[model samples]
Target: MTILIALLSGLVFGVAFGFLLEKSRVFEPGVVVAQMQLRNFILIKVWFSAIVTILIVVTLLRELGIVTLHPKPVLLIGDLVGGLLIGTGMTLAGGCPAMIMAQIGAGYRDAWFVVLGGLAGLAAYLTLELLLRPLPADGPGPLTLAGLSGTPFPALAVAVGVGLFACVIALERLRPWRLDLGAQADGIHHDRPGSPRRP
Candidate 1:
């Protein structure tokens, strides 16, 4: 019964996430690339909001004893290097793993190429495992500000969430999107690359 509940919850969350991605229009190649180039702030706003939201929710669940916190030990060097590679690939491909799926759902035939490239990269990583031998075996594990400062996780999460929210608001005020909800009516339109204007 627990397993079934988990599966159902995953399905519901997955659909909701995809819906949000599509509605945000971040699936558009131009919009994704624009975020990478820092000409637009929508994607960052969404990313930070999602992260903070999850953090806060999970923290609450933990506090309520509904969920236990079990963070995995992370290899600092490995994660840093891997993150750089993934970021570079996303910049070149104009979409990340989740965004690629959203793009395909939006009838972007080009997203197939990105998917193929991702598969190829995964294959290469598995085959070239020996090349990653230099990754540090022992490194600092998860070190959140709460852990470092001896603050409660809920308090830290709430503070981080508030800071991120303020940043998003400031960004929106500074460089507002030209077309808000009206952009959706126009289809998946996007402005030229590097321009501050957006769909």
Candidate 2:
């Protein structure tokens, strides 16, 4: 019963998140490509806001003893190389893992190639494990802001979240992306087939 509840809740949250992704136009290839090219900053702002929100909620829960924070093992060189590869792939494909699904939901038939390419990459990584084994895993392990700075994690999270949120706000004030100006007041970007929405 607990497992079933967890699955159902996960489904609900996933659906909600996907809906938001589509609505935000983060799923749009043009937006992703533009962000990768440093021509647009809306995607960064959106992610920054999300990170702040998550930090606030998670920090509160952990502080209240309602949840425990599990820090993942850090492999600096492995992460750096993996991040480079993933970023390159995202730039070329114009979609990350979640955004690929969002693109499919938004009716982009071309995104299927991105999904297939990702799956193929995963398969290649699994099959070529011996060749990839040389990527170093030795690094300063699981260091968090609290551990490094001697502050409570929750306090550190709140401070960082507020600072980041403020920076995003300032950036928006300085130069905002005008993706939503054309959106309808009724909240429907487009209703007809072949018409694009700003989400």
Candidate 3:
């Protein structure tokens, strides 16, 4: 039942993603690349807006007793290592996991490789985790950014909010697309590259 629910939720989210991607007209290479090049700041603006919204919503909900925030461990070293690996992989692949799925939805046939790569990555993570189960539970217990900073929860949240706002402000003034999303698509769409897209 949990598996079924998860699968259903994934499908629902995929449909929603498609609807929004189409509605926003952001699936177009021009939009994605423009955001990347700092030409248009759609990516930055939307993400920072989302981060701020989530922070506010979660904070209010926690204060209202409508939700519980179990502060998770902040393994700074693990995070730094994982982020570097993921960043390198993304740079080489020219697309992250989410973008791969978006391309697949956009009728890109080569996304199969991306899907395969994602599955392989997931499997490797699971395998490594199982092999090294002793480190996670025993190593770091209930670490948080606040714990590191000795700051109150609200202070940490405010810091995060300010950082997000600053990033959005910085992105709002970018010029135009420098790296073509379609080119990064890696021959995914054989049609007119960087063409004016309607859908």
Winning candidate number (TM-score): 2
At residue 166, candidate 2 shows an lDDT of 92
lDDT of 2 by residue, 22-110 (tens): 77777677677777876566688889988988888887788789997779767788888989998999889887888888878777789
TM-score of each: 0.80, 0.81, 0.68
1 or 3, which is superior by lDDT? 1
lDDT of 1 by residue, 1-199 (tens): 5999999999899889889998776666667776777766667777887887887889889889999777666778887887898888888888888888888887889889988988898899889888777675667776666788999888887888889889888888887764422355322334546646652
Q: Is candidate 2 or candidate 3 better by TM-score?
A: 2
Error of 3 at 152 (Å): 1.8
Off by over 4 Å in 1: 1-12, 178-199
Candidate 3 yields a Cα-based lDDT of 0.65
Model-by-model lDDT, in order? 0.76, 0.77, 0.65
Best by lDDT: 2
**Superior candidate under TM-score, 1 versus 3:** 1
Pick by lDDT: 1 or 2, better one? 2
